[model samples]
Target: MHGANIVLNGCSDRGRLDQRAAELRSAHGVECLGLFANLTEPGEVDECYRQIFARFKRLDVLVNNAGILQDALLGMIPTDMVDRTFRINTFAAIYNLQQASRLMTRNRSGAIVNITSIIGTNGNQGQAVYAASKAALIGLTLSSAKELASRNIRVNAVAPGFIDTDMTRNLPEGKFQERMNSIGMGRIGQPDDIANAILFLASDLSAYITGQVLGVDGGMLI
Candidate 1:
């Protein structure tokens, strides 16, 4: 195992999740710096990156994994809900990429993995805004990859389906089960499933791959 030191930004909120992550890091002997930042705010992002640069002096990987979903049909969705979803899910990724790419271009080597969703590729009812935000991320991934490829920066995305996370746990059990049955694997995915794909994208194993959307959905996208 490479004792790769990492700064995990955006882990400060949500009931002190950073505390638990820090505990795990201590147990594993990994240097994990957790910072608090509201990703939707540019000023917070800037400050977070400044802290990272001040400490690490270099950034090798950026995982744009912070996202929110407001599920409502387009006609029924409130303007505020749509705007908030885009601000956090889509725009935040772009803003992070803007800063991350600048640092990466200087190093001429970095990897960016955006967390997307299968709903982005295959539209779903009552998830218009969420889907749209993720779809925008896919586009951003491709465009950023093309622009950063010459600099040796790889930009890619992972589209997850029916993942068993706190977000999905809030769904009605019956509805969640129904969705799981549609997956070819006959089960929901885990966060590690997406995380593993992210690890690969960040590792040298995927050195030649870029501008790709690796679907971690059990054949759901097909």
Candidate 2:
């Protein structure tokens, strides 16, 4: 908990966001603003940015952590599912970065962390759509980092390896065990493990780092 002012965007569940905001406020004394936006819509994204800037005036760090999984074999994957995956996972980040970078470059300093996946690099059996989207995001992180470096804006990615989030927990038990067994650590990575990596990338500690993907996957790639 860095105790910074936080604006959460693109949430459709206002009640849950509000409850989480209240909890964060009570625990860390941090101000949290929850805003709703259909991230797939460019106009909604612009409106969300307007609200964020109007309220906070400045954005120190942005974490592009929104994504969806439509797991299907490459041949079995539907056209719409692939499009939807990219719509939320890849295009949404591009749109958000367009708005965010304009502000960050104006100030000449900021950090952006994109949440990716190990599947992007290593590939998986039934994750063609998800993997392609994440792979695209990794490309975006690198290209954006170089493009924005002159303005003192840093862009990096965190590739979580089978982290224990809502997405992973819902996997079939047998598949989950197989994945866990493959991990060198022999355990699922907790959410905080990834959060800590993002925190470092977003902080002054990583001032010299840019255009890199830090894997928080309990040695899955190794």
Candidate 3:
């Protein structure tokens, strides 16, 4: 932990968001704020950042980690599912960057780390839409990095492998084992694994690093 003092989770579900914020406060004694916004809405995203700026006075680091997994094989995939996936994964990141960079550019120094998935780079079976969204995010990172470099803003992304989240936990038994075996380390990643990676990229230690993608996949792709 960077001792950031403030931990915010941007989610539409205020109940769960508040609960997670409370947990952060109770566990680490850190002040966490829950901001509820339909991120797909550009105005809402702008308003959310306004609230953050009002509280924090300035923005330093932003981790665009909000996403969803709507897994239905292409062709049969629901149209709504495709729309939702891109809206949350790709378009929302762009919106957030627009707002975050607006604030960060004022300070002329900040780091933006987007949470892309391994599927983004590797292309999964039932995740074509998800992959495309994340792939677009990667493009966004590179362009934003170049555009904001003059402002001393650094942009990067982390592509996480099969981490043990609720989303990845319910794979059929055979599918689970298949994924487990694919990991060279023979273990699915933990949230901390990805968090540590993000910290490294966001911290001053990586002062010269920008417009890059760090794959925290435990050798899954290899």
Candidate 3 per-residue lDDT over residues 15-58, each given as its tens digit:
88888889888888767878888889999888888888888867
Best model per TM-score = 2
**Model 2: ten consecutive residues of lowest lDDT:** 1-10
What would the C-alpha RMSD of candidate 2 be, to one decimal place? 1.4
CA lDDT, every prediction?
A: 0.87, 0.88, 0.88
Model 2, 1-222: lDDT tens per residue? 277988777467878878887877787888888877888889999998888889887788889999999789868999999889999999999999888998787689999999999998788888978888999999999999999999999999999998888888898999888888889988889989998999999999999999999988888842
Best by lDDT: 2
Model 1, span 3-108: residue lDDT tens: 7787776544744658866875888788788877788889888887888788888889999998898788668999899889999999889989999988887889
Candidate closer to the true structure by lDDT (higher is better), 2 or 3: 2
Which regions of candidate 2 fall more than 4 Å away from where they truly are?
A: none
